[model samples]
Target: MSFGGEAAVIGSRRLFAIHLFTATGAALALLSVLAAWQGDWRATFVWLGIALIVDGIDGPIARRFKVRERLPKWDGAALDFVIDYATYVFIPALVIALGLHLSTLLGAVLGVIVAVTGALYFADTRMKQPDNSFRGFPAVWNMAAFVMFALMPSPAVITIVVIALAALTFLPVNFVHPVRVVRWRPLTLAMLAGWLVASSWFLLTEPPLSAGIKTLLIVTSLYLLCVSGVQQMLPRRPKAGF
Candidate 1:
């Protein structure tokens, strides 16, 4: 192919990556919906968690390599917002509604989820630059943690965890965007490799390894949250004039 053709193809591939991220998020949301239909809380959590991981990185990945330039025709920002809202807010509430058998308590919980997430989205839309520092527990993480607890098969535990997560949803807590473009190197590659390996193992295997996979997922989630917290606490360099 000619050089121009080759360039066009590479650009197309980059755009494809961004689209793939959103598509993966949607797929997970769909999976959660299905899980709820079958009353499989475990499956719902698993899919919801997977979506969280993907949604967390999508935007950063797009910006990291300048994927935006590749698709002048497509609005990456808008696509991201749509995916984020659907996956983190709508899907989780739907899953919970189904899992809880659509009782009055379920309706109440769903309302809270929607309210908290809507506030988050409103904040995000007004941001001049997407803050690497989150101002809240992060709608996605709250949903993931709740889903995990829901799968535990203990009504008491699920109720307690749900309540705790609900409170957290409104409390400010930064979550890492999951990509640090400035520091892309061996460390970044290795961490990404770890995530891929762990997530793939969890998704591919069954039963006997379920407990282990859940542990790994929790650790990863916490690690990402911690990293974001530390970054936020680090003192920023003052302006030269100051």
Candidate 2:
């Protein structure tokens, strides 16, 4: 075979490997659900966190390797959506139902609301606007549920927040995609790294999250919420693209 042909074959193999790596995230998400089923909340969150990290990094990696261009036969975006729904919506909904220990009636209702709203949000192709900002609240149920669990707030607070978030799913509010938003990418990424550290510490530490870590989580969450809102109000310029 010619050198060009050999290079093409090698590139195809590399792209296939990237696909497999991306798909492993789904496996981790599945494991998180299994952990939740076994009533191991800590293990479940750990697995979910790993899955989140995988999801965060894989997009840039795929772009770097030109996975879509090189392997047009494989739909990485579709695969990502499938796994994302599992980890982001389904498992987190389960966390509310089982881990939170809400009343049977309320738990069932909230779980259905979360799952259905998330499904609808994911199905909306317009979720990601032309400016690369999420047009709605962005169904980040996984992160929301994780923070709620870590904080262990009053059930009433949890219920109110869950309902609010569910309603926000359909609202036309711009939510920043940390990696994709160029104006604040550096600050966003730095805060995200701190959040990961704080989250890991909170998860591993004994229950009833310490004052400092809880404060860290709250601050980080607020930063995300406020930054997204502020960014939406700012005039758009051709800053960067993902």
Candidate 3:
């Protein structure tokens, strides 16, 4: 082969390597499930958080390297979806069901609801709008499970929150895709970072989160919800023609 042909092959191999790196998040997520089964809640969340970080960075890395263009035969997005469902929905649901110590009936019901709603949400093509905002609650059961575990709320409150989040899966309300949405992106990321820190602290420490940390979390959560609400209320202008 000519020099140019050799270079092309090397570049393609590099892109494929990036694809494998992206899939590593799924492997980490699987390890998280094992941690949960071993009754190590801290390890479970730590692994999940690491997986989340991987998922967060891989998208930009893929785009920067143009992995799709380099490896047209492989579907990175589909692979990501598979991993996302496993880590974000399925494992989190399992953690909540087993770790939370809810009644058996309630735990089973919550698990089914989380798993089914998350799967349906993933299958919905219209879940993301042209503006790149999520058209619904976006099946963030991982975050939900984390919050629930940190708060250690009452069983009744847990039931209500779980059911409400599941119901929101089908609603038309727009949830901000922090990385994708242009408006308030910095603020969103800042708040998310704070929340993550608080969550990590709570997860690593003993049962209930500290009062100040808990208050910070609640404020951050409310801020994100309000941002979504405000954005939803604003009329969406027509996009320019291609």
Total clashing residue pairs per candidate?
0, 0, 0
TM-score of each: 0.59, 0.92, 0.93
Candidate 1: which stretches are off by over 4 Å?
A: 1-17, 49-61, 100-103, 114-119, 125-131, 141-143, 150-172, 177-242
Alpha-carbon runs more than 4 Å astray in model 2: 1-6, 234-242
Using TM-score as the measure, what is the rank order of every candidate, best first? 3, 2, 1
Better of 1 and 3 by TM-score: 3
Stretches of candidate 3 exceeding 4 Å from the true structure: 235-242
TM-score of 1: 0.59
Q: Give all candidates' CA lDDT scores.
A: 0.60, 0.86, 0.85
For 1-242, candidate 3 gives per-residue lDDT tens digits of: 99999999998888898889889988898789889889987799888888899899988999998888879999999999999999889998897788888998889889889999999999999998877888778888888888888778899999999898888888888888877887767888898888877887786677657799998877876666557757779766566221
**How much does each candidate deviate from the true structure in C-alpha RMSD?**
6.3, 2.7, 3.3
Residue 1 lDDT (model 3)? 100
TM-score: model 2 vs. ground truth: 0.92
Model 2 steric clash pairs: none
lDDT of 2: 0.86
Any idea what lDDT model 1 has? 0.60
